[model samples]
Target: MAFSAAESKLVSIFCQSVLYGVYVVLFTATTYTLLWGNKARRSVRRHNMLFVSFLIFVIATMHMATNFSRIVLAFIIHADAPGGPAAFFNELSNFTQMFGSTLYVFQTLLGDALVLYRSYLVWERKLWIVAFPCLLLLGSTATGIGILYAFDKVVPLADVFVVQLGHWITAFFSMTFTTNVICTSLVAYRIWTLNHRRKHGDSMRRHALRPALLLIVESGACYSATLLALLILYNVDSWFQYVVLDSVSPIVGIVFSVIMLRIASGVSTEEGETALLGESGVVNSGGGGVQLSVLDADPDQKTVAV
Candidate 1:
């Protein structure tokens, strides 16, 4: 069946509504991050997390706001009305619509950078292990910048350039997904390897690796799955691709904030610590750092540095 313009617009609106539902979670998560960061004591990691989370909060909000503006501009103005959807969007000169794309790209870059940084830390600060992801990040950033340049320079772009835009988007999403996968896998594997040395509260399960592993997988999977969907659909030439594109920024924001919130709350991991079970409220075997009473270490066993 042929796709009608009204049908397309309806799908786009539906996607935006779904994103708004997700945004509720985004706002909540961000508020929790802010509150938690405010209460956290001064430390290198604490200060860094606060700064990064705050920066992401600002960028994610901008991205969501831009999306809302474009959605209103696209849907509220009737196509038959003066300066309808076509005309408004046709003017690539109209900065608002395209601005969302840039904001989304910026947010994606920041998220990728954060994950890579965590990976670097988890791997005993071994820069070589994360070097590949870092390189991909740089390339992804350059590609994203190219897209921005394309939007600005090719206002009222030719029909032939649509495929060019698609290619750029595909590259961007693919790089991000790869980066996420590598970072998440490295972190999870490192934790899994350390699971054998587990020590925790039998009553509360406060120091178990299973829960920490689950949280990391679940949270990272939620974000990765969305991007993977978008990446797969990018080449399919479907209306749903447009819909997924519409919801991209909000979904990323929600996932990013949710992870931060969990960290801040000390639910999955502690602020300013490595993403390990010990970081998830375990009794630190190393007496030099935090000492939680919830779980006790075996006197006969050696303290393994995770």
Candidate 2:
């Protein structure tokens, strides 16, 4: 079935709206965890995470708002204009559309950078480990900007599957996909290696690391899968790409916040209070990185201090 641009836009808006609502609830819970959920003392790391959370939430909000505006312009404001909503949405150069695209670019790059940083942290701050992923991120940023510029210069009302924009967009998508896969793999490997090294420990301690690794892999997979779908649909010139594209921002925010809340949940005290406390000073507490806190293991307790 060949779906029209307007149909894609309608589906995109609907999916994005639902995702945005979910993101709002997750963001609220994440905010509470970072702010007051910690029964123990708060550190600069928590504050930093809170700040980044707020920033990402704001960006997602703006993306959603711009999308809503675009919807209005396409469906209601210009319903009877020529080709109707399809033609209106095809105007990628329009300011509102451009702005939303820009936000998606920014949100994606920010998430990639955070993943790279997390990789660096989990690898014990080994600068050499993240060196290549950094380069990939640079490539992603360049191609991302390139695509945006190309969008403005492309023939008015032309779809994004055209030659001028295709190359840049493909490069952007591929680079981002590669960057995320590499960084996420690195983080997951590091966690596994650390756990493997502690194989002689008690079962509780041995199983503690699994949750962290699982959380990282599961969360990373969500974003990677989305990107892969986008890359495939884009190359095939499917109108369904718009649905994936519009949902990207909220998905990014949701994934990021989910990690925060999950980790906080893991390290929560036994009294059913959620907290993220590091036994040895501050661990990998950077914003958006897997905040790994090594709590002192107790022989009698089956606590998850990953």
Q: Which candidate achieves the best lDDT against the true structure?
A: 2
Clashes by residue pair, model 2 = none
Worst 10 residues of 1 by lDDT: 271-280
Can you tell me which runs of candidate 2 are displaced by over 4 Å? 39-41, 199-219, 264-306
The whole-model C-alpha lDDT of candidate 1 against the native structure comes to 0.61
Cα error, candidate 1, residue 118 (Å)? 1.3
Expressed as tens digits, the lDDT of each residue in 1-306 for candidate 1 is 844333554676567667756766666665655555543442345656667666765666676566567667666864566656645554554688568777778888887887787677657788999999999999899899877776676637332137547677678889999998888777766644533344333521545655465546533656667778878866665545656666766666666666656555443343223333333234432334543222223334344332
Ten-residue region with minimum lDDT total, candidate 2: 269-278
lDDT for residue 216 in candidate 2, whole number 0-100 = 58
